[model samples]
Target: MSSKQPDTGRLTEPCEGYLVTPPLLEAASFADRLDHALTVLPVAAVRLRLAETSPETMKRTILDIREIMDRHDAALMLDGFPELVRQTGCDGAHVEAEDVAAARKILGDDFQLGAACGFSRDLAMLAGEKGADYVAFGPFGAEPETEGLALLTWWREMMELPVVAAYSPASEMADLPLPEMLHTLAATADFLALGVTQDGHSFDALWQTPEKFLPLFAETAKD
Candidate 1:
């Protein structure tokens, strides 16, 4: 692995927060809830993971959510639709590891292109070399793998390409408090990709008060 960090440098906070949309959400209703949730939390971005729907419906959903994201200055990244990014006026797209180069080409140099790299550092580096804006690392879940955490630490120390530490909390841990879950994740990642909805707890309910989790973002800068 290349030890040279990129010119971009590390963020002051240990991790920045990002949200993953529920696998299925009604765009119109979800937009209102999303808008309200964002108004309170300081999320860096949101990945729209709408279910496979008609192209027109998908476009409309993206448009509706895009408007709210725009207002809050949070990036709206299409889950796996690089082709629809420009048409829907989205900030960027998140593509599978093998499709990183294609997505980058389609979105060009301006849009944010992210790669889902799982636990493969080789794949992560490959995506970065291919012009990915960021690389996502694994389904770390509640019981994170030691190797995964080590890799994340190494990447943070060696690379400036941002990483989103993806997690799919185990179903058994569904009732765990969101703040607690987030704190556990912050230890190993700079951004958290939460796709699983724990017991139908809305983001609003999980992050009901800023005081509960905002301090995690206010710690002294990491060396």
Candidate 2:
């Protein structure tokens, strides 16, 4: 692991959180839940990922959540929808590694463009070179990859672009607390992009009660 510290210039605090939309975001009720989450948690960004739906439906879904995100001052990043970013009034777009350059052209310099690089350093570097605002590293899954951590450590130590340590829990680890998982990731990642899908876990509980997990972020900063 790299000894150098991750950059905190863009964040209000030393460590910050980012939220990933649940798979089923088209539901009207989910927007309310998202509003509650953002209202309570210190989240800087929200990646809106939706299942395949009609263009009209997608726009409506984004519009519903956009208001809440805007009120909270959280950047709403549309997943794989660079073209619709401006039309939908989104803050930015998150694209795959292969589409970084195209997305950048579509979004221009002012918008926040992020890239999902998976575990490839070459792709991550390429995204950065192509003017990505940040690079996301992994799903990391139940068995976290040493290489993924190394990549995050290296990116944090060397790059100015932010790094999001993403986690999508495997079936075996669904029972673990979200905060507990976040605590482990906070050691190396500047931002945590957590999937809101843990079994028996409530998003309300995670955000409303900061005492349970927010301190873990503060603790990581000290290290």
Candidate 3:
């Protein structure tokens, strides 16, 4: 290593909230939740996810959510569906670290591209190198855990690329309305992705936006 500390940058924007839609995609219901969320939360983007849904429902859902997203000026990112990004009117695609290069080729340079490098520094680095617009590091959908916090701190200090502190349940910290762990993340990350919601912490049960996490963004603004 060089004697001189190499200059590395971190996310300048105070961490903004990011939404990952629940597994089910029902156009009308989700649109309402999303609109409500946009009005209240400082959401930087929304990741559309489909666990089980028909093709018709998928298209309609995408169109419905797209309208709300455009109105809010929040990006509509399709999770793990680079192929459908343009066809479905999505603003971008968030894929696994391994898919970063291929997804970039598919989406090209204009659209936003994010990679989920859950708990793996090596994967995060590879994703950044492969043209991911932003690399997300965390426990993804896992239960509440604290291991991910250390990873976020490391990335913030050592990397110039944008980092997202993926959300976890609020069981770790005590006597706090919102998860104290989440508030700690605001200092370092660029975006905070909503994960499994704990009781008294949920934004909308159907949407899983995490109401308590709103305070950080509510108090501050993001560019």
What is the total number of backbone clashes in candidate 2? 0
The digit string of per-residue lDDT tens for model 3 on 68-137 reads 8778868888887787787887888999999999999998987789998989999999999999878888
The runs of at least 3 residues in candidate 3 whose Cα sits more than 4 Å from the true structure, single-residue gaps closed, are 1-13, 140-147, 170-176, 195-211, 218-223
TM-score of 3: 0.81
Once fitted onto the true fold, the runs of candidate 2 whose alpha carbons sit more than 4 angstroms away are 1-13, 25-27, 172-181, 196-212, 219-223
lDDT of candidate model 1 versus the reference: 0.71
By TM-score, the best candidate is 1
What local lDDT does model 2 show for residue 139? 73
Q: After superposition, how far is residue 173 of candidate 2 from its true place, in Å?
A: 5.0
TM-scores for the candidates:
0.82, 0.81, 0.81
lDDT tens string, model 1, 22-75? 754457767665775566555678888877778888888888887788788578
Q: Output the number of the lDDT-best candidate.
A: 2
Query: Residue 169 CA error for candidate 1 (Å)?
Result: 0.7
What count of clashes does model 1 give? 0
**Alpha-carbon RMSD of each model:** 4.8, 5.2, 5.8
| Candidate 2: tens digits of C-alpha lDDT, residues 127-162 | 999988888988776565778878887777778778
Answer with 2 or 3, whichever has the higher TM-score.
2
